[model samples]
Target: MRRREHESLTAGPVCPSTRSPRYTCRKLECVFSLGHPSIARLLTIKLGSGHAACIRFNRSGDLLASGRLDGTIVIFDIETNGVARKLRGHTRQDWKCVLWDLQDGSRLRTIRFTAPVFIAELHPNTHLKFVAALFDDQPILVDATEELVVKRNFQSAPKRSQLDMDEATEKILAQDAKQTTTVTTFSPSGDYIIAGTNKGWLNIIETASCQTMFSTHMAGGVITLLRFAPGGRQIVVNSSDRIIRTVHFPDLTGKNVDFGNFRLENDHKYQDIVNRLLWNHVAFSATAEYLVASIHMNHHVYVWETAHNSLNTILEGPTEELSAVEWHPYKPFLAAVGIDSGEVHLWSVIAPQKWSALAPDFAEVEENEEYIEREDEFDVVASEELTKRILRQEDEDIDVLTIDPVKGYGDHQEGGFKMPVLLHQDDEDSEDEIEAIGAGQYRRKSPGRGRDRNTANEATHQNGRR
Candidate 1:
């Protein structure tokens, strides 16, 4: 039998005849490795009650407020991962809106209406104030600090001229009456409040006066969702017709508009299923450059470029039906989505890479090498002289004409037409002229022929007749 080599932990594999002991070499094993990780799921909290109907994060991002179909609102502390407060007293008919203290997971107040509350939004400027839309009544502004309705404006339905109408018209009118306000939001400046109805009517009301400034029908179906983009200059409206339109606020001219007509790629099989679900979801990015919308029952989120009204990307991670989606306030790439499976997911725009480098340091350097090199190459003296020369040239090109006060026209010569330059008179002179005119003592020049010329013409006509 052939002799086998003996291996030892700390001994050489060769025999002792060798000058130096040759130990068996092993690859180094690392305990820790450094690399850039791609965007992925961070943390998920299961509510046990299935899907949450609505979720909103406070301004400080310390607390998350979620409302469920069981008419309960749970406020969760992000850091501690505990339920800070639980609020009750709402019905499960529709989605409920809640307001909470951003710093602490404390329930500020809850506003309940007689009908189903379809939409609620906190005032952009006021912390403890918000607005809610009701099914049977008008939208109301509630002050959480005082726990009362500060402003309520009910929109009156259009009246018919004659009480006697056809049966078809009356049925149509009855259907219209059943429609409710579905969405409500405030302008960025908090100057105006916009509300949408199920019947496709959009009303823009001035918050200060509580009066409707403009009202128009946007589309035929319900207005599912409406959001005022950053800067509050434009608003995006999503209707049940699957048409997304961005309109200029305070104008509503519908001109120079950006529209996204969503059509499923291969939706022939899922058309009926998707039509049954209600899609009232829309989210705007931090910079308002991108918009993410949840397609009802489609298990897909469409990321759109607001400027071009085209698809930027398609997110297809949700396995079940989607409930809602919200974008991170500060991070443009990060977004949170809620699905019917009782799981909330976080997504980012970063792609996975094999050979990754540390995220480029955003820290500012006092003196950058490239900046210093460019500075040395720049001709500062020449630039300064050129700037001064351009300024001087602009000043020279400016024509500064002095306007002189009007002077009275020279005495009328012969029959030449002359215009008198009226001068501004003193107060006393104005008063005197007014009194003289009132007393019928001021004779105004007649624009027609003079009195002497008229008398001479009349005398010449009489002589000719004789």
Candidate 2:
């Protein structure tokens, strides 16, 4: 048996600068800044039924695939911008993970975990082979191409009796749950395969012997995702508890001295559920460099840089439900899923408008006088209007605001008042100018209002309704 000698450290969320909110970095002095582009729009790609859980893209960036609750895999051809093919295999209730071969789209694999899947990943060298784990069970390495099992091991899993939380005094083997909720890929060298479970355990396995090399408990919430740096010097894991942690592993040939092997140094925790996470999340200036992640149930995406260990920007919007999110392989653009409605939103992670951030500036005035006055008026209007709309639900005469520019604001426009929609123009000025410009600049682009305006006189003679 070869003895391992090495030290490991885990650093909490990379706070390039000391800031407030304890876990989060301060804004002005904050080292990490995620820039946003001028234009932002939620692009909708319709996937028929069942909530989409996970998605993967092929290497060429032409094919997009997603696994759904209905135990089916849907593939989309970006060139056609439509659903291309559907693959069926998992008979399980819900599909949890899917891996699309970057080198070859035909070589794909999907996992349907009976219990929630803790982690899943493909070997860096070969997409045909993949590994996944559930809870404290053994990791399953499958031949993706053939859908055959390659190896399964239970040696690292703790006995069922050891899971008793009350048995603190008992000396039991350790189990790793950190970075377990999501599968992780290893360095190109394939030196180590790490898995973190929901229970806060981290298991680092050596590929050579296919044995558990290091196991430790990462004290955070559920590890949602795990990613290794490009050169393989560091490893990152995030949990639903809003904590992002980095684990350091020395280069490949640097002697296997176990530098305590399991050291968790720094971590950053936030106040939300960590959702979709990715390495090289965004690309700026034609060079790809950014770590992007979205909160599971929230409408915000975080951008971090691996070089400096800092947050770059935050892109937010898209309320219903966020299922899967990923960055454009060669661009700073991003795409996310609204699971419930099957709405796909495309956003630029760089140079956001910062309109959402300016809310605090007008929040007081809006809350004090102007907001109070409108609140009373809006209440009466919305109540009367909403009541009528609800009653007319069965009838097609119901007129509802499909997409309001000021969605939650209580400023209900007057009846028949045409409003301009900035949706057509990708670039809208800052919030201040947008408000100062007034409603005149907003032109109503309602579904049926166009043709009638140009041919109003011509159609007036034939149609009596006008």
What is the number of backbone collisions in each predicted candidate, taken in the order shown?
Answer: 0, 48
Cα lDDT listed for each candidate: 0.51, 0.46
lDDT (tens digit, per residue) of candidate 2 on 1-466: 1111110011111111111110100011112224432334443333332333455554334455655433445555554455555444443434255553322223244445445444455566654555666553456655545666445543344223234556644344244221233344455466666766556666666665666665667645555566655445556666544566666655654446473544555433333234433221222221335666655445666666655766666666555445455654444445666543444555543343555577755332234453335545544455788789877886665458564444432342223122122224222112112111232132223555556776977688669765
Best by lDDT: 1
In model 1, what lDDT does residue 345 have? 49
lDDT of 1 at 86: 48
Candidate 1 regions with alpha-carbon error over 4 angstroms: 1-51, 60-63, 76-99, 102-110, 143-151, 156-179, 250-280, 333-339, 349-466
Candidate 1: Cα lDDT at 394: 80
Clashing residue pairs found in predicted model 1: none
